[model samples]
Target: MSKVVVASFVLCLLLLHQLASVEADDQMDRTAEAKSDVSEQKIDCKAACAARCRLASRQNLCHRACGTCCARCNCVPPGTSGNRDVCRCYATMTTHGGRLKCP
Candidate 1:
């Protein structure tokens, strides 16, 4: 009765403690994975952006947007005025209003 209740509460607390510890370990692993991905995914954003934006209608805005997209995705399509298929992620990303975000 009372003893059983106390035992169950203690067991539940121990289980919760174990779950929290596992969650913390999982978070640490995910953080490490993210760091590794960032290092591995670094790209020559300046050159990529310049190439992509060279013939754009709005050079300033194109350079800015292309640089941003290249940095995030580590890729830019070749001869990039309209060949966004080379980098599908960059091509598909959209603004809050559903407009294409990349240059």
Candidate 2:
């Protein structure tokens, strides 16, 4: 009788541990999904800013303004630029590899 009780207790503990692990995994999945959503939003905001810059005649002001717009919209600043409005705006939106490479 004692042996049976011990076995049952062990089984219950194992089940509890498994449940905890599953809960942890679910929490991690939720976190990852939230991060993905934020990234998508940032990308969308950047694209919109790029479009605005394009329409503003290649002025650095447009691109610089776009970066600020992105920040207000909850995204990391793309970077700074010195070209005309169009090029600067494009760089601000697409400059991903650390620093801006000017021609």
Candidate 3:
């Protein structure tokens, strides 16, 4: 029982360290983008969210979800809807039941 607990604690620590490192990498990416002059790579969150949810029947819900996701990831697919390939990070985000969470 003690050995199992020690192993679990170590695993948790390792997972947390990995998460912290990933976050640092993401910050670096954001920093690089800020320093770049590429207009195409600069995400206007409002416009991107609007574009992402333009065709949705539930406009309010779509706007809310898309807005949140866009703000967090700075990405949305280059379309009104569907074809999530271009927005890989957004596409892979999931709810508790593993359904796609981004609008």
Candidate 4:
């Protein structure tokens, strides 16, 4: 009877440990998701596009196009122009007339 009791106690402990491990893994996943959300939020499209369009000759057109591209791509390259490689989506977007949509 004592041996049976010990075996049952060990089984219970193993189950508890497994549950705790699963809970820990779930918590880790939630933490990673939250961090990603925060990082995504940190990308301010308005401010980034404003900075990107600062040097353009056509300020209104630049801002409009940059705003659209930034909203779609969630990123802007680090200059007034010609760094489209940094944001592939911005680089590749096309207008109906086959011209690049982004400034």
- Model 4, 41-72: lDDT tens digits are 74787899889888889989899998998888
Q: Judged by TM-score relative to the true structure, which candidate is superior, 2 or 3?
A: 3
Give residue 42's error in model 3 in angstroms.
5.0
Candidate 1: what lDDT? 0.88
Per-model tally of clashing residue pairs: 0, 6, 0, 0
Candidate 2 lDDT, tens digit per residue, 65-99? 56664564444333343333444444444346765
Query: How many angstroms is residue 89 displaced in model 2 relative to the true structure, after the best TM-score fit?
Result: 14
Model 2 alpha-carbon miss at residue 18, Å: 0.5
Candidate 1 local lDDT, 1-103, one digit each (tens):
9999999999999999999999999999999999998879778889888888788888999988888888788888888577888888899988899999998
- Per-residue error at 48 for model 2, in Å? 5.6
Give the alpha-carbon lDDT of every model.
0.88, 0.60, 0.84, 0.90
User: Which stretches in model 3 have alpha-carbon errors above 4 Å?
Assistant: 1-42
Q: Residue 88's C-alpha lDDT in candidate 4?
A: 96
Off by over 4 Å in 4: 1-10, 13-17
Q: Order of all candidates by lDDT, from best down to worst?
A: 4, 1, 3, 2
Q: Which ranking of candidates, highest TM-score first?
A: 4, 1, 3, 2
lDDT of 4 at 64: 93
lDDT of 3 at 88: 85
